[model samples]
Target chain A: MAETIEMDDRTIAIGKNHKLFDVERIRADFPILHQRIHGKPLAYLDNAATSQKPKVVIDAISHYYQAQNANIHRGVYYLSEVATQAYEQARECVRSFLNAASTEEIIFTRGATEGINLVAHSYGRRFIQQGDEVIITTMDHHSNIVPWQILCEEKGAQLRVVPIDDHGELMMDEYASLLSAKTKLVAFGHISNSLGTINPIEKIIQMAHQVGAVVVVDGAQAAPHTPIDVQALDVDFYAFSGHKVFGPTGIGALYGKEKWLDAMPPYQGGGDMIKSVTLEKTIYNDLPYKFEAGTPHISGGIAMAKALDYVGQIGYPQIEAYENDLLNCATEALQKVDGLRIVGTAQHKASVVSFVLESVHPHDVGTILDREGIAIRTGHHCTQPVMDRFHIPATSRASFAFYNTKEEIDRLVEALHKVVRMFQ
Target chain B: MDTDLRDLYQEIILDHNKNPKNFHKLDPASHSAEGYNPLCGDKINVYLQVEDGKIVDIGFEGSGCAISKASASVMTTIVKNKTVEEVKALFEKFKGLVTGKVEPDMLELGKLAVFAGVRDYPSRAKCATLSWHTVMAALNSKEEQAIVSTE
Candidate 1:
């Protein structure tokens, strides 16, 4: 049964005290957070850009390199078998993480950027036709926007964008109206990186399905914060990066339904993605192997599994509850600053808080905050179009994670007040 | 309560940031160019008024960090009433000072030499140099379009 939530300040305040995990213990697991920056304790609030790895994840990568370093899937040797087993186990772990229907549906790529490019080049080239419409949202990251723009340009198709309101929420009504007979595909982000607005992807998928359009979800931001069930959402394609989830970089997963995977052409051609090859013609391998052409990042894949296991052991439900509390604390504390305006204040948001001061540039704020040992992301954040939509050059963002605390937010607020006083 | 990098954030940089110089649009400028640092999203537009090979007036206006804005403020002060050749020589001296290729003589660079400490931060070197690069670009190039970013 769905849990009914009370929508009042007191109930929300009560919810802050009920986290399932121990925040102090969780913070201890991350070694980087304990360091001193510029003589002050490092208050890392750049979780949206990338998360610091825990000891478990660090040891897992080191252990693999030291003990089991071999190419996967191609050797009769003992070490090769061990490596292959670990790689496939990682795939299964990711399958469970996303609640995917099968391991065959998951194809590992470099990251979400590469995953989107693969779909745009392979699936879009094969299925989408000229004069067709591909709908995306204003809140999309550059990775989601540029690849589709390239595909649409190549196929002579038109790209349509669904606008968002001042609150940084997608206009679902506008999105629904854009769906028509000519709409071939609909791609959007599950959670916006810049705004932290969680899109109603299930409803979006159902609406696109009514118009016979395929839906692709950019889950780079959502995967770190929420429980993702690809099957329940019924999204045709979903992509996320490992680095953002406390895993090693250069590894990510793309989940496409078996039917769609079977229908799409191979993304790249090489030894692994083929069943047999002659000079004249090449027969592509089945499902995922067809997409994963080259020898993959073996160490990265195994390390990602360890990262997923780390998150699993902590319990995502617990992590989410704790992070929401941090978000509330940060929002309230930051609001108290004079001349400060929170940029994205959607009703439903993740752990990110993007804001701007009345007269201060974000770069200036970032530089001053750095002296206080407060690490936050500042600038356009690779979402220039979103910046354009907001009519600001950039914003200073402080994104939270489960390991963060209210005390750290207190430090941030204190530092921000000093910065404002110094500037104004 | 204190950080080692506090020396980099000296009072002069903050004062210059609060009261920036040459911070107005110069219409009918003989030369105007914009520069951007994509990494930090710091932008600057340098405008020059040249008459008879001497810079009569120099103005700049844009948004960026304290370092970039302060550097621009100091740049406008030094480049005024100077010839093109003198400005080019000053650019080289300033570049060398900020990159740590040479120890800055504060007597020569005036308030601009305060930014010599920024060379320690490799990532922020571009932020410090953004406006100077725009000045150089506007002085050298014939193009009327704004240069987006130095980075």
Candidate 2:
């Protein structure tokens, strides 16, 4: 059940500094970071939206298209054999990446949005009956919110929103009060993309299970930052995006518990998803392939494996240690900026820092920062309810990746000073 | 100063953004409409006091970026005392100027030419046109609380 993992010099090398992580080498792997923007070196802090791909992942994609370009699963020729092996191997890669029980539980979709939609349409149509309750959080992305709304309307179910406190932490006491025997499903984000607040997902999952409600996690923001173990969490379904995890776009994975996968009907019906199709009736394929219909994103699937492996090589023990320091560094620096107020002050947070400056609109701040070659997201971040909760139109958010350095944080602060002076 | 920055945030634009002209509601406004850009959540409400088809007074009440605020401020200053037809014509010319289809005529447009630089930045083009569109919607009074989107 286990393969030998070789610990090479690359894995064992330890650096000396406030940051023991090798950020320089990590930054070198990403090609896009080499260029200059507006005559200034780029400080890419928009990690939450999407991460820049490393050269290895890019190369893997190109290699697949160039060397092994063939339809997988049914082909008998050499190229097809290689393609099938590559594709199936990637499935195993995903299984190992998430520590999922089996490859049958891993289904590839376009992105997290598609993954969640598949669950809502297929599972919600079956298990969620009339008068059933579906609970979600107020801080969820519109992608997570809208699908459930459509499902609830279709199923004649009620959608309850769990509120968040002033510090952007989910109101756990309020959440406990909301749950009851009527709640058939509970969907929540593992981390708030806008606020970067790490939620108590395990505790939430345990509570949901006690009431017989299946938990679906929106792990789009957490996949890149934290290590995921589906077996340990025992979450019914976990969805994540490829583009956010240093992988190619148009590809992502949804990990569903095998029992739930078997219980839920196929989301889409087409070729390669049928065991038998007569003139009279059709029998759907088994487990994962039933959900994944027709020609999938073959190259993207393989590239996602490469991206996961890239991060795995760095290891979470080292990555988390580095990110915590980076978060602290950025937070302290941002707090010192005049008229600046950090929005989410949760006790536990990731590398995202959201803030607003008095009398300065986020658009103006974004424009000024862009001139300085600093890329930060400026808007409601597709979390409109969260914006309403804070009573601000939008915020300037800077999200960090492993490649980000203290030097870049310094550049952001200097650029922010220019913004304040410009507004003054 | 960066040349592009100066072009984008001209002194006149900044001045208008800070203290926008005619930035208030008309109590008994004949025509009014709200404009919203969902992309950045920018909202602008244009209020017009038209007397016998002539825009006797015009004002706006809302919040947006400096470009949008300045564009609305400049619009009110130029279109006052103009007829409905003339205001519509001026809108067409202003749109053409900012989109780089027409050259700036400072003698005619006054400070509105400051927005001509918006053509270089396509995303900012919507910012330049949001308030103008709101006024057009207000003139053709379909609803009192009418809102149009710059999608």
Over the stretch B18-117, how does candidate 1's per-residue lDDT look in tens digits? 8988899788899989898888777788889889999999888888888888888878888899999998888888888878888777798876778877
| Root-mean-square deviation of Cα positions for candidate 1 versus the true structure, in angstroms | 3.7
Q: Model 2: what TM-score for its first chain?
A: 0.96
Question: Residue A394 in candidate 1 has what lDDT?
Answer: 93
* Best-matching candidate per DockQ: 2
Model 1 regions more than 4 Å off: A1-19, B1-6, B146-148
Q: What are the per-model numbers of colliding residue pairs? A: 2, 0
Compared with the true structure, what per-residue lDDT tens digits does model 2 show for residues A96-145?
Answer: 98999999999999999999999999999989999999999999999999
- lDDT on C-alpha atoms for all candidate structures: 0.87, 0.91
Residue-level lDDT tens digits of model 2 in B43-128: 99989989999999998988888888989998999899999999898888888878887776766776788887788767788889
Q: For residues A1-424, could you state the per-residue lDDT of candidate 1 as single tens digits?
A: 1135433322222244343355677788999999998778999999999998998888888888899988877889999999889999999999999999999999999999999998899899999999999999988999999999999999999999999999999898898889999999999999989888888888999999999999999999988898999999889999999999999899999999999999998999897899999999999988778999888998899898898888888777777777788888899999999999998889999999999998788876887788888999998988888888998889999999878888889999999998777766
